[model samples]
Every structure is written in structure tokens, then in C-alpha cells.
Target: MSEMCPCGALLGESLMPREMAEEGIFSNLLEILMSASSEIEQACKDSNESVDLDTCLLLTAECFRCLRNACVECAKNQHVMRNLGLISTSVHLIKLLHGIQMKEELLLTALRCSLQFLGNIAAGNRDSQNSIWKCAFPDLFLTCLTYNDEKIVAYCCMILFTCLNSEKVRELLDPGNLTVAFHVLKVYKEQLESEWSFLIVTDHLLKCPELVKALYAKLSNQERVTLLELIMVNVNEKNPVTSEEVNVLMTHADFLAGCFQENCEAVLKLTSAADAEDEEALVTIRLLDVLCEMTSNNGQIEHLQSLPGLLETAIDTLRLTHIAGKQAVNIFTATHAMTGQEEISHPAVGFKSHLIRLIGNLCYKNKKNQDKVYELDGIPLILDNCSIDDNNPFVNQWAVYAIRNLTEHNERNQELIAQMEEKGLADNSALESMGLEIEKRDDKLILRSVRKKPS
Candidate 1:
């Protein structure tokens, strides 16, 4: 009988089975697997159209499985294990196993078998880590996220995160694949009820600062503005879905702060100068809130300096009776508290100037409220605030009385005197005749007696 051809195809009336018998059949299988691996690799190199390559890889994976089992079954054939080991050493075989659909148990089996043998050959000899492993199986991983397969998606995310740690692997990653993975994260961000999405994305983001920076750069200014607006809305909504939203915002605070600093002038110009009646003012307010929260983390003072007019704008906005001054104050106070530093290092400039201006305004208002304290609901609040103002006296006196229950120490009385002197305010002789003596100290002015006037 004529020998069968090994191509597995027929020409004319001749049926070519690639090879004959069990041994020849195994040899043909090995050849096909080798060729298939080569084609798959070429496909990877040429383009991302790996569907056909994947199908071929699947066939090769099955061949590995059949051959490995055959080797075990024919253990009596002493050469079987050696043949299996030889096949495993083929780089093409390893690539084939890696390229096959990871979802297939058979493919996974083949991978285990191949790795076990290849691991031995490459043992202690550092070979490049498997490059194919870094190719994100976007369709599979994303499907896992879409189907709410949290465990699998988490596992895949971890794998991808690790793979991305390698500069070489990261460079090899297809941008489209990266985008799909990111979209999976975004979908999880929008769809998942739990915070797994946030946790996973945040963990990944923390690993890749370059990725985060690139993402920020890739987003258009409008997109970034929208993201900031979204974060602000979530943070300030009546009730947040989860504290995770706030935590995520905080995690990216530095990035958010940079963006805010870059676009602050534009933002302020748009919002501050916009018609007060326009809805954009609300957007501006939200943006400000985000900026405030971003800066609420450590190093905020340095971050704040990057924004040219942010402090002035904040101070101006807070001074407005229309804006939420209390809220603004709370934000500033939180920022200051976090940094353990003053809002302005120079109490003689910037916020201090604004604060002094505010004190003057409050003092003027307090004079108007003096006779109408009972009728003016803001009297107590004004009195409380005035006590802290270093530029007001009439207000400080009432403020001191309001807090008299808290401290009997001369500090409070002395503070009042210092404030008066700082503002060039002096006691009226009418009150002095009733006995009040104001003494000036190097750092402060002190009230010494009720009956003496400074000569």
C-alpha cells in the first residue's frame, strides 16, 4: 500500500492523512501544532485579529491534551514521556497553550502540562516572563464584570495589574485592550451596587501613577470638568451611595488638585463672572467644593498655592451673604486643620487681609445689631465670630461676654484690649471715669484697672 501523505488533505483522487498509523498520526499532530503556533504568533505580530489564530490555538491545545494522555496511557512505551517533554520544550507549544482560549478547561489543562515541563527547562534560568499573559482577555474579563462575576473580574484585574508592572509588558498592551479594560471599570463604577468596582479601580490606579496621569491627559478638558462635577455632586448629595465615593475622591486628591490648579482661573472666570441667575454658578460651587475637599488632604497649602486666585475667590465667595459662608468656612477650617497651618502664613496678607476686611464688615453690622440683638436672629452668631476678629472692639466686648462662662482668665480681657489697640481703638473717657485702664504690652494691650487711664 502507498504511504499516506501528512498534509491531512487530498489532492485529486488521493487521500492524504498527513501521515499513517498511531505514531505517524502523533508526528503529524505535532507538526500541525507547531505550524498553528507559528501562525498564531504571526497573527499577533500583524494585527489584533486573533479569532482565527485562537481557533487554531484551540486545536493545538486539544492535540497537546490528547498526546499527553496518550503518553501516560502508553507508559509502557518508555519513550512516551521523553517525547512529551520534547514537545513541551517547543516555544511554539508554550505560545500555543498561552494563546488558547483561557476559558476552556482543556486549554487550561494543556497550559498546566506545558508549564510544568517548560518550568523545568527554564528553571533558575531567568527567561522573559510570558509576554502573551499580559494580553488582556478583554472580552472574557469584561464579560465577567458585566455578568457581575466579581471574583473572576477581580482575579483578572489582579493579573492585568501585575502584568502591567513590567515596563515591557505594559508597552506591549494594545491601547484598545486597555480601553476595554477601563470601560469595564467604568461599567462597574456605574452598575455595581457594592464598592468592589471602586476598590479594584483604585487599587489598580494606585499601582500605576503613569496610567492615572495618562488617563487625565487623555480626557478632554470638558470630560475632566465633567468628571470633577460628577465627583462633587456625589460627594455633596443629600446622601451618598457609599463612603467609598468620598474615599476614591480622596485617593486621587493630588491628581484632582493638579487639574483644579491648572483650570482654576478658567473655572473662576466662568463661574464668578457668570450671571448669578445661571445654573452654572451651582456647577462652580460644586467645583469649588471639590477643590476644597481635594485640598483638605495633606500638603493642601502647597496645592492651594498652585491656584493663583483660588484663595481670593474663596474669600470673596464666603463674604457673600448669598453664598453658604458657613459651609465655606467649614471647608477652609477643615483644610487648615488638616494641614495644621494657617490659611495664610502671613496674617498680614492674603486671607488675613480678607479676614480683616470681613471683620470690618462684621463690626459695622454688629453696630447696627447692638440695639436690636433680641430682634436680629444673627446677633449671637455675629458675637461669636467677632470674638475671634483681631480688628474689632465693640464686637469683641460682646463676644467676650458671650464666652465669659467659659473662661475667667485675664486672657479674654487682655485679648479684647489687644484687639482694640491693633485697630487703634481706645476706651472712651466716659467709660474710663467709671474706671477702666488699658495698658499696652509689647505683644498685646492689657486692661489693668477699672479706675485708671494711661497717662
Candidate 2:
């Protein structure tokens, strides 16, 4: 008899071009796994010795690894494994190991290897993928995703990414079950540090604009924040936004505007800056950033601006954060003047700049929004926020852009800004700090750079 390791047989078969099914290697591997499962169950029930359980787990893991290797790019072996009920066996073993409190490393390793097998076998095979999906669609996958083990969570995500066809994704997005998918996305955001497995799955789901729209409609406010963060992650990565990303932004523009409106309402309700310094405010700040990105895309700005309460939300958020930020700066300056300690700007400090950016994009070549901002007295607010702040980086630049957008082709807005500068209502300290001085020449404010003496 040939002296061959049962777990190593399929691995060798994987190295050759010949099909494992042609040589009955798949059957042999299944037999080894069955024998190992029996041993594991028997050891768990009857044996008090830890060594017996460890040995069986190691054998089971090896068998899983062998099968995982065999199924790699081998449709015949994958079909054979599925036909022999390996998928159920793998899920059963995972459930078995999940129940047992044996060595943690061995147990998790077996679980991870089992998921690897399922993922590879179902990689490109629709029938096999559907089979695995039927066995472990939401509950088992969600349960595995909640595991503290990142590798296990990542493998579960891989299985999801592999098996979730468009129909399945839409099914998962249904109201009753979307929570499970949403939970997986939350886990992707909060739990997993690695992005490959999670990114592919999220990217795939986000590609279906209508499906994503439905998914967005079903999320609560907090869940909406999480989903926006996920979308922003992908948006921030691509240099020039792809067409697919543009479609997503266009589809969600109105909903995103409504989300901002709700977040801004929450901000306006807070009576004090201290109350606005919590995680909810942070989420609001992030939502502002997302809106900033959305408005930057010209195609979506009209949709965003047309939504009721968007302008009110933007102005309200700016006014609230501006008051809080100024109070924070005043306090910091008074206390740190002599000590020269670096001021830590308030948590809401960045909110002003982002809100300004949103206003700028909304006003870009849009006279109606420009007239509306002037009516709301937002120009002075924008002018006042032009000074530099450590927390709101590039705020001055955003204010400048907003001013230009507010004035472009709008004589009323232009006159308002010019009047503010002429009355010295807009302080000159901001201009002097930037080594630029404004002079009224020919009834126009001309910005002139300051000259330095030669050294």
C-alpha cells in the first residue's frame, strides 16, 4: 500500500492539471473529512484528554486546507465536492467547532479553513455559489462576521463577496433582511481593519444604484451615517470619480440632502457647544463633508439644492457651528495668550469650512442660490470665517471660493461683499496675515501683495 497522507492527497492532485474527480480524489478527501468529523465528535463527547481533541482539530483543518487547495480553479473538483455534500459538512463542522470550547486557535483555524473551502469552491460557479448561499445566507454569515477574529470575519466576507449575485444582493436588501446586510457593512466599517474583502462586497452592492437607493431608504439616521462613511471611503480613493460613482451620487443626491437636513436639525436643537461635542456631532460633521463632496459634482448640485430645507440646513449648521467655534477660539485665546500654548480648536470647528464649501458649490454659476445666500445674510458669516483656524484647515480658501461664487454674475451679492469690505465690517487682519492688502482703486477693491525690504 502506498504510504500517503489522506489530507495531502487532494493537494497533490491540485498541483497537476488532471481533474481530482477523474481519479476519485474528491471522494477520498470527503471520506477523510468524514472520518475526522466522527473523531472530533467522539473526542468532544467521550475523551477528557485535550490532546485527542487537538489532534482531531488539526487533522480536520489539514483536510479543509487540502480541499480548499483542490477546489482552486477546478470546476470538476468543486462540482464533485458540492455533489458529495462538502458544503453542508463544512458548515456542520464550523457549527460543531463553534459549539465546542476546545483550544481556541485550533477551533478558529478550522472555521477559517472551512470558509476558505466554501469561498473557493463557490468562486465562479453559480450553482455551487447558490448552494452555499442557501445554506448560510444571512444568519450564519452575520454570526461569523460578529466574531472577534478578523481573519474569520474576512473569510466570511469573502464568501459573501463570492456568492452574492445581483438577485441575492437585492434579496438581502429587502426591508426584513437588509438589517443583516447593514450589520455586515457596519462590521466592515468598525471591526475589520483590512479592506480588500469588505471593499469588494461593498463596492459590488453599491454599484446597483436602485438597490442602493432602496437600501438607503430603509436605514435609520445612525445607519445612514455609517453607509455614507462607507461610500465616502470609496469616493476619496479614486482620483477622478468613475462613472459608476457618479451614478451613485446622482441617485442619492436628494436623500443625502434630506439626511443633511435632519442632521442640521439635530445640531440646531443642541443648546450649547459642549452638547455638540459628542459622537453624534462628529457624525453630523462627517455628513457635512459628504455633502461637500456631493455638491462638488455639478450634476448633483441642482438636485441637492432643489430639495427643501437643504439651504436652511446649510445655513443653520453654519450659524450653529460658527457660534460654537468662535466661542471656543475666544476662550482659547484668552487663556493661552501669555502661555503661548497651541489652541485645540473645538470639535465643531471644521464644520464651518465644510459648510462654506457646500455653499460655494451650490452657488457656483447659480444666481438663485447666490441671491438666497445674500438674503440669509450668509455673506457676512462667510466673510467672518475667512480668518485662519488650526482645526479648520483651508477654511480661508473655501471662504474665498464661496465669496467668488456668491458674487459671480450676481450684482446684489457682489455689492453686499464690496460694501462689507468698504465699511471695514470685514476685518483686514485676515488680508494682512496673508501678506495681501486691499485698496480701493477706480471704485474697485484691488488685492495687492505687500512688498518686503531687501535683506
Candidate 3:
């Protein structure tokens, strides 16, 4: 047969000579250059037609494996540009990578691999920076935000977030890209409940401080209110634990703080009618805690003025003995102390008892509020309740703490402690067990005790 093509014949006939092929001699002698070149040429011809970009991208990804094998030869001959068609193919693939329906995992893998190769070529070629490929590709990167896949949306957000650091890339992303990113956040917010996705978007927003400020500026009052309401609803929802809820609250903390500072009365108005029967009270309490923490510096004095009554309501709700309501009462107590406000007293004995108990708890459990604890003129009343015979540990523990905190600093407090001690109201064993040591010096009673457990 007119000297069978040496390369194919050599590859085939070498199989018969175990020593030659198996010993790796004939294998080294054979060259598949024409075979690989033919395949690449075919891929290039296909790229010239209006082929499906996804199909072309998949083929090119496979070709990269073959190209890698022939890299030494291709480099020696400087035939790398012969794969210009592959770069063009990547440009087309970038377009197909847009839409919302593409398989996110597959598309992401292909696009990243192709982009890596394109970047490699650009790095290798001196003129590649000025090539049309630069302009042709970034738009596709922007379009990635439109993908319906939350994972892909999160990935695109991360990429955009990183790209913004580059002055050149930042210039390329106009308001349109930002708008697209925000839209993606809105559209896929529900899917972004995962902690990773939430953190990605949150970090992105935080890095772009201008973006957060812009969002604050662009949102109308009603829109801002609605956003807060949505956040509250999500935080209150009985869904599986997700990062999105926590992130939403954390991300919006600054904005909420600003809103409270600007109009505390308005924000407080939203929390006015929390009902004991509503399960959402716990969330309301949490939001209040966040607001309190945010405004700890007394930025919203008027806002805090409205809290004591709510604190009273929360304390009453705790009588149902729900742990959540009790926790809420604890938070409300802290908020009152932070705001330099006292819990408003109810006229009824039962309600007043609850208030006294809450005050006692604060006096004992919260050291930050020690100064504020002295502000409650109800310490003597709390000591009287403690002196009464009650089976409630809540009452007894708080009473001891209130006695300790109240007596720790003042001579007047020491006289009350002595009165309680004379009435046998002070539990000596309990005091000893709690490791509290009280000693009198000159004009003041000293607390020679340290907190064994954190309050």
C-alpha cells in the first residue's frame, strides 16, 4: 500500500514487537502531531460557524487536555497562535454563559477553565492586553449575575467584589453592573439563605461602602420601613437556621442605627403594640436589643424614653414562665440600663413584684448597669420582698443580688442589709455558698466577692 502512513503504521505494528513498544522505544519514535493538528483544525473550523457556545466550550475544554500533551511541540514550533480559533471560541462561550437556566456547576467549571487559558495566553503575548478579547469578555462576566442559581449568583458576587479592587476593572463596571448585582441580590435572596452565600453578599456590600450609602439614599422611607419589616419577619420565621437571616440583620445594623438616630420615635412606634400572645414578641425583643446595642451611646434618647413601659410589659409576659419571654425581659432590662432609664412601676402589687424581681436580677446579673442599678429607688422594696417567705428561687436569688449590689457601695444600703439580716431575710448559707464576702470599712460596705459564673 504505498508505504502505509508511517506514524499510524508504526503505532500499530509496534504493538507486535513487545520489546520495541513495551520498552518505550517505538512509542517515543512515533509522532501524533498531524493527528492533534487535524483535531485542532477541525475545532477551529467549527468555531467559524454559528455553533452553540456551550457545545464549543465543552469541546475546547476537552481539547485543552490534548493541547497540554502537545505543549512542548507547539511551543518549540511557535504554533500556539494556530489556536486563535480557540480564543475566539472562548469569547463566544462567554456569551452563552449568561442566561438564568444554564447548569451552574457545569457552566462555571467551563468558564473558569476557559478564562484561565485565555489569561495564560494574554500573559504570554505582549500585545494581548490591547486585544479585542479584553472588551469582549467582561460583559459576559457581568451577565453572570443574572443566573438563577444562587451558588452562581454568589460566585459572581464574589468575583465582582474582588474585581472592584482593581482600578481598571472598577472603571469597567458602570452603574449598570452594580444595578445588575443588586437585582440579582433581590431576585435570589430567598435562595441565598445559606451562610456562605449570605456572607459573600454581605462582605461585598460592606467592602463597597459607597454601595451601602447609595442603597440607603435610594431607598424611600416606605421602602426602608418595608425592608426592616421583612428583616424582622425573616428573623422571626421558624425556618431552619440560615446565615441569611443573621447576615441581613448584621448588614442592616448600621442603617437601622442611622434610622433610629434620625427618627427614634418613628422606629419605636413600630414596636409599640407587641402582644403577650404573639409568638413574634421574641423577635421584637431581639430587634429591640439590637436597637439598644446600636444606640448604646444614647444617640436616640427619645427612642429609649418609650422603652420602660415595654420593659414592664415584657416582665409581665415572663410570668407565663416562657424562657423566651424571660430572655426578652433580660434584654429589655439591659436596654433600660443602657439608655439610663428605669423600669416604670405598675400600680398592682403582682406587677410591682415582677418589676422588683426584674430590678433585683439586673442588680445582681448585670455589672455594666451597676451604676444604673443605683438609680432604681426600689431597692428597699426589693429587699422587703426578699425578706418575705417565698419558694421562688427567681425571687430569692435576685433579692440576694439586689441586696449585695445595693449594700456594696452605700452606708444606707448597709443599714438595709442589717435590717434584712435581723429579720433573718438574708440567707447566710446562700450568701456563703455564692461566695459573697461583705465587710464594713469606715463609711462604706465593701463587696469582697468575685463573680464565679458570668452573669
Tell me the TM-score of each prediction against the true structure: 0.35, 0.79, 0.38
Among all candidates shown, the one with the greatest TM-score: 2
Candidate 3 per-residue C-alpha lDDT over 1-455 given as tens digits, one digit per residue, 9 for 90 to 100 = 32322111222333333222221221221222223334444545565644354554455445443332232212321133333344454445445444324564555655554444343334334344334234443575546556555544554443344333333333333555555434534533555454433443344443343455555455545334333444444433323246653444444554544443344222222222343223233333333444433323232323332333433332333322223223444222212222334343311113223444434443333343344443443443454444332222245555565566555555555555554554576654555544564566775544456566655
Q: Cα lDDT of all candidates, in order? A: 0.40, 0.70, 0.40
For candidate 1, lDDT tens digit of each residue in 1-455?
Answer: 43421111122333222112256556676677667767766765667755464466467656654443343212222143235434343444554445534555554544444433322222222221132232224443444344333443443343344333335324423565556445534645555553444444444443344554555555544334444554554444423146654444445555654453344333222222233333333334445556644443333324333444443333344333213324444212212222423343311112222332322222232322222222332223322244333222233444334323211343553455446545656343422442445567786666544535379
User: Against the hidden true structure, what lDDT does model 1 obtain?
Assistant: 0.40
Listing every candidate in turn, what is its Cα RMSD in Å to the true structure after a full C-alpha superposition?
Answer: 18.0, 5.7, 15.0
Better of 2 and 3 by lDDT: 2
Clashing pairs in 3: none
Give the alpha carbon lDDT tens digit for every residue of 72-157 in model 2: 77788788889989888777778777767654798888888888888788878998999988888676786787777888887788
As a TM-score, model 1 comes out at 0.35
Better of 1 and 2 by TM-score: 2
